[model samples]
Target: MCAKKMTYRDALKEAISEAMRNDSRVFLMGEDVARYGGTYAVTKGLAKEFGEDRIRDTPLSESAFTGAGIGAALGGMRPIVEIMTVNFSLLALDQIINNAATIRHMSGGQFRIPLVIRMATGSGKQLAAQHSHSLEVMYAHVPGLKVICPATVEDARGMLQAALDDPNPVIMFEHVSLYNMSDEIEDNTKVDLKSAKIRRSGEDITLITFGGSLHKTLQAAEELAAQNIDCEVLDLRSLRPLDHDAILASIRKTHRAVVIEEGWRSFGVAAEIMALVMEKAFYELDAPIARACGVEVPIPYAKHLEDASVPQVPDIVAKVQEVLNSDV
Candidate 1:
């Protein structure tokens, strides 16, 4: 496999093109996916290569197009549906929850929805409340669906193929801020979706996060290292079926845990992860688990306010410090 530095956007495009080339059953459907080349340009020029039939574009009807994607998947095709953003995905919630997620159980295991839904998520770019939000938790709450957040360039290139191969529906959340982020990745690397990955190894404390919050958590780890606090960073790649083994193992080693998320703390993904740690690894903890999360308010349009609403690098560092300082 060839290794080269590339932006997250290019990596996603390569993943989609590769998937389509390898599987004749794979096709993409969404608003502006073809002529407009996708909202983030991840599918740009794919239409020229795959043609309109495979790279079909629809009007501004998320529910209709998403339902069509579900239908296509049920009809023996692997369909990749793109909802413009997480905010817009609400329009297609019925199709996703009622149909795509429940088809197997409802049909008594007679049908499977091998569909992959990709959407831009997280708060950044000053897009205001409507366009910016981290709602991956809502999707993860569902029992039958699989949710994955590709926090790195390697994952951005590999997770799509893995998602397509799954028998159940998979929701892929791509942080908008990461589209321009660049990293070195092998051309043909395949990422497994079953487990969380430890981004850094340490013995003092464990920092757990995913999606846009991962980089910030890693930054916090770096700063903590300078302060003589060795921190381990775990990227929770798959949210629905969380890597419980990896989480417990890391917490067992470090004994101190800090969970971070771009979503609000109450009932957020962080809360769920914290619960898991508490349930399974409570005896191993040296202190109470800490959490850094988004503010419980509508995301503001102003740049500074937007930055304040979500978890930042400084917030993560401060939380980790607080956890370390707390006495059992």
Candidate 2:
């Protein structure tokens, strides 16, 4: 297979471009997405290539534009709605959870919302508390939506197409920290929106995570390798319909697990995974399942404080070692 190296931003742009080229129904609408080339520049040059009608720039109102996207999808258009950041997405919560997510079920299958909402999420750029937290758990908690966090270049490039093919709504989270991440991906790379991928295989412990935290977890695994602790890194690509089979399989093999998340510890995604393990794979555990999550507070603005608030490489390594050395 032919491979090419590109930044995560470029991969996402390629996905959007391919989708638009293949389907006339596909169009993108969001703030600064057209003329300003997007806040992150992912949509740069796309406006010119696709024309203003296809690549649209909207008002500052998230709710207004998001509702417009939903209407477009219901009217047989594959509308991609870009909420500049996860924080701004809150304004569109009613439109998203109420309209886009529920119209299909409310209409008793008569209506299907083929909406794709893309948002830049997570911290690392020092954008401060308002612009920074990982709010994926809120979206994942909803039953009618498909929530996905693409952690790799292949997924960043391929998941958009998969989402567009689905009959319902899909929410795609692109971690702000990963925009510059570059890697070699196959030209034929295919991505499924439902599977969890095992990036690194091991038998000692499973370091379960997704999105931005994936790289940090991988680095932690590397550091742990020197101490003879083999860590398996499982990327929970799809947060909504989590691949329980893959998660359980990893835990059953390792017998010890440490779930990692950038969200706050209380009632976070890690907690849900931990509960699942306890119920289905309780006997497989050699030690209590552990979690390394962000501190329960607004994300700080200062670089050092922000770094301290979330789970870092050292934190993950220490948590893994703690689980390994536990007598319980």
Candidate 3:
């Protein structure tokens, strides 16, 4: 609603800018985000408005700067730390998985790290193994950290505000390929940080997903509908504290589910979702749940192979049909 034609990228940027305007304590820091306006230009002009002091740019040391941002959050300021990619987030894993994740619990629940770390994830630019990875499940596995994946324009707009307002540390994962996507936004475009949104409603089957793969699921839902198979789409925006109620409700209605995730098939978020559904919605399910996930391999550099590695529209459509057609 802030921009004439809203993009997922702009929504996130505007949310941060609005937060900065409303709260002096909200600041930003990352590599090239200040001067270069970020690798994807998410903060193209923020440095000029907030000035370099607040919109700080740090050295390429992901570990040092990300840790510094965490320290800054502990001291006072609400810092939004931008890691260039999920691939690079591994460099700061110690800081994020250890200190930032454990501080609140280690300090007898006295300290709250109100830090927001944003990073681009998933493979779409033919960036090989080192440049592309979806490790959101790893972050979500931590007890004290909150993980969010905003798969829509409105969520991309609103989640940052909710994340900033939270007293605990939050990591937001944005897929690189989704930055250019444009979507409709209403004036009442805000959303809660902790709940899931049912993007499309149906009773035949549930297409469960978040982040980059959510759009693929939605497209599959439409394709399935053409064949008279109605699919329910659940966007698990908050990956960590998944809104199980939304998922179970849909599965309870559809009596079936097909999870879609862009990450590798092994130990992925999709696997977790399927497990949760089986445990909580077992009696409600009329058929076995399924998942359409990335092939179990390092993403290849070739265009076709890269495309083959991740979940695609065709794969989701096929999986939904298979789930719907399967016997319990």
Q: TM-score: which candidate is best?
A: 2
Write model 3 residue lDDT over 1-328, tens digit each, in one string: 4445689889888898999999999989889988899998899999999999988899989999989989998998899999999989999999998999999999998888999999999998999998887889989888889999998888887888889899889999998888999987865466788899889988788888999888878888898889998888889999888888988888888888888888888998888888888788789887888989989899889999999999899999887778767866
How well is each residue in 1-328 modelled by candidate 1, as lDDT tens digits? 7789999999999988988999999999998999989989999999999999999999899999999999999999999999999999999999999999999999999999999999999998999999899999999999889999999999998898799888889999999999999999987788877789999999999999999999988988999899999999999999988999999999999999999999998998889988998888889999999899999999999999999999899999999889988949
What TM-score number comes out for model 3? 0.97
Candidate 3: what lDDT?
A: 0.88
Model 1 CA lDDT for position 299: 90
Show pairs that collide, candidate 1: none
How much is the lDDT of residue 124 in candidate 1? 85
Candidate 1 lDDT score at position 39: 86
Global CA lDDT of candidate 1, please?
Answer: 0.93
Candidate 1 residues lying further than 4 Å off, grouped into runs, are none
Error of 1 at 55 (Å): 1.1
lDDT of each: 0.93, 0.95, 0.88
Rank candidates by lDDT, best first. Answer: 2, 1, 3
Candidate 3, poorest ten consecutive residues by summed lDDT: 184-193
**Which model is ahead, 1 or 3, in terms of TM-score?**
1
